[model samples]
Target: MKTVYGPYRSWRLGYALGVDPICRQPKVCNLKCVYCRLGCGGIMVTERGRFVDEDRVKEEAKEILDKEKVDVLEFRGTGEPFLAKNLHEIVRALRGLTDVPFGIVTNGTMLGRDDVRKELKDFDVIVVKLDAVDEDGFRRTNRPHHSITFERTLAAIRDTIAESKGDVIIQVMFYKGNVALADRISELVRDIGPSKVFLSTPQCPEIPGLSKKELTDLVELFSGMDVRTIYTECAKER
Candidate 1:
C-alpha cells in the first residue's frame, strides 16, 4: 500500500497537495468511534510508537513539498500524531523544510500533557475533535479505550487551549443517535476559545448515523459563534 496518497477531498481544510504524516498508536485512546475508516473493532492501544520511520517521513515530506504545491500539511492518519515519541522533532523538521503552514487534525486526547501541548504550539493550525459534549454521549459515540475518561479528554482540550499559540479549530461531527448537548457544547467552545468551530457531518459513514436536518439546525444554532460549515457538496461524497 502506498504510505501516502491524497490531495484528496477535504471540505474544511482545502486541498492537500502533499504527504501528510500520521502516527503509530503508542498510547491508549478514549474513543472507539464507530465511524473510523480503518474499521478497527475498537479503540485500544493495540500498537505503539511511531510506526513509520520518522526519518523516512521527514525525507518524504521534504521531497513532496519540493515537488508539489501543498495548501496545508495535515497530521492525521491511522492513529494520533502526538503519540509519536519524536513528535516535537518531527514538528521542527517539518517547519524547517517548508514555508506552507502545517496543521494537525487530532482527537485532543493527549493535549493535557505539558510536553504534548507545548509541542503542538509550534504548528500553524490545530484542529481538535470533540464529537459529543457529555460523558454519556462521548461513551456511546466514541466507544473509547477503558483508560480514557470523559473528564480527562475534556481537561486536555481546556488545558491545550490555554497554552496554545496557534490557530485552534474545533471539529464537531453531527450524526444520528447522538444526543448532542447544544448548550454544553457551546460552553465547551467558549472554554477552549478557539479561533473558530466547524459543524459538519462525517465525510464517511458515522457510527451513530448521519442527519442532514440536525446538522443544518446545528449550523444555525451556532451561527453566533465564529464557525463555518463544510460545503454540503464536498461532504456528500466522503
Candidate 2:
C-alpha cells in the first residue's frame, strides 16, 4: 500500500499531501464514528503499535517532495494516525525532506498520553475531532472504544490544546446525531480555546449532511473564536 498519497485541494489546508502511518488493510482505528467516510468494519484497538515502516514512509515522502508542491504534509489516511507508534520517527525523518509545514488530523483519543502529545507538538497544525460534548452524543456520533470515555476524551483535547506549541485546531462535524449539542460543544471548545475551530457536516454520500442554513446558525455560536465552515470554504474555493 502507498504510504504517501495526495496533494489534494483540502478545504482546510489547501493542497495537502497525505501520509498514512497506519497503511493497513481493513483499517485500524479506535473509533467507529457514524459519519466516518471509511464506513463500518475495521480493526478497533486502543493500543499503540508500529504498523508501517518509518524508513519506507520517508522514502516515499522524499520521492513526492522532490517532484511535487503541497501546502502541508498531513498525517491522516484510512484510520487514526496516533495509533502508529513510530509516528514521531516518520515526522522527524520527513521534516528533513521538505520545508512545507506538517499537520495531522486526529480524533484526540491519544492526546492524553505524554508521548503522543510530544509527537503532536512537532506538527505545525494539529486538527482534532470534537464532535460531541456529552457521553450520549459522543457514543451516538463517535462510538469510541469501550475504554474511552467522553469525559476523558474531552479533557485530553483540552489539555493538548493548552499545552501544544503548534496550532491546535478543533474540527467538529455537525449532523442530526449531535446537532442539538452545538451550544454545549461550542462552550467546551471556547473553554479549551484552540487556535481555530472547523465546523463541518459529513461530506460522505451515506450520511446526510446539514443544510447551509443549519451550518450558518452553528457558526454564529462560536462567535469569538477563529471559525471556518465547510460551506464557506467551498464557496471560497469556487
Candidate 3:
C-alpha cells in the first residue's frame, strides 16, 4: 500500500480515509495480537522513532482531501501509529487543509509517553486498544513485548482519556483464550469512562467468536456502566 490506503468501510468510524505514517520496508509494531489484520508476523519493538516522511504523508492527505469525500480521516496503516514520530506533524498538516474529523487507531502502549499523548490529544476521535487488563490476560490476547506491563498500559489509557480533548473509544477484541476477561475489561470501561466501547474479534485468522447471544449476555455484564457497545457482533463478516 502507498502512504494512504483506504476510504474503507469502518464499522465504527464511518467512511475512513486512511493515512499510513509508518511506511517502512517491513511493518513494525509493539504487540502481536491474535486478531491483527496485518497477519501474525512483524518486528515487535517499543522504541519510538520516525519511520516515514511527514512531508509525503501531508502531500498525499492533501491530495486525497481535494479529490474524495470521506466521513473521517484516520492515521492508521501498516503498524502502531503511535510509534510514528511524525504523527503530530502529519495531523497538523492535514488539519490545515481540511476540516474532516480525524481519528487514530492505536495500541495504547505509548499513551504514557508525554510526547505521544501530547501529540494525540487533539484528534476528533481516538480508538485505544484495551484487549486485556491483567498480565496473563494480556499475554494470552495482546502478546506484547516483555517490557510492557498491564498496570502501566491501563494507567496510560486512563490518563489519555482524562486528558484527551475529544472522544475516546476503547477497542477490545474477544476470543476463546481471553473470553474470561470480560468482566475485568468491563470494569476498566467503567473506570476509564470512555464515550464508547467496541467489542470485536478477528476476521483474518477466523478465530472462534462469541455468538450473538453471548455478546448480548456480555453487554448485560456492563449493564449500568456509563458505556455503550457500538459493535455487538463479535464475528463481523468481511
Q: Could you list the CA RMSD of all candidates, in the order they appear?
A: 3.2, 2.2, 2.6
Clashes of 3: 0
Which residue pairs in candidate 3 collide? none
**Candidate 3 residue lDDT tens string, 137-232:** 888788899998888998998888887789898887777777787888888777878888777665544677766566657877666653434343
Q: Order of all candidates by TM-score, from best down to worst?
A: 2, 3, 1
Best candidate per TM-score, number? 2
lDDT of each: 0.67, 0.87, 0.78
lDDT value, candidate 1, whole model: 0.67
Per-model tally of clashing residue pairs: 6, 0, 0
Worst 10 residues of 2 by lDDT: 229-238
Candidate 3, superposed: residue stretches over 4 Å from native = 224-238
TM-score of each: 0.83, 0.94, 0.89
RMSD to native, candidate 1: 3.2
TM-score of 3: 0.89
Q: Pairs clashing in candidate 2?
A: none
Once model 3 is optimally superposed onto the true structure by TM-score, how far is the C-alpha of residue 236 displaced, in angstroms?
A: 10
- Residue 137 CA displacement from its true place in model 3, Å: 0.9
Quality of model 3 by C-alpha lDDT: 0.78
lDDT tens digits, residues 52-134, model 1? Answer: 66577777777766777767777766566666667666667777777877788888877776677678866788889887777
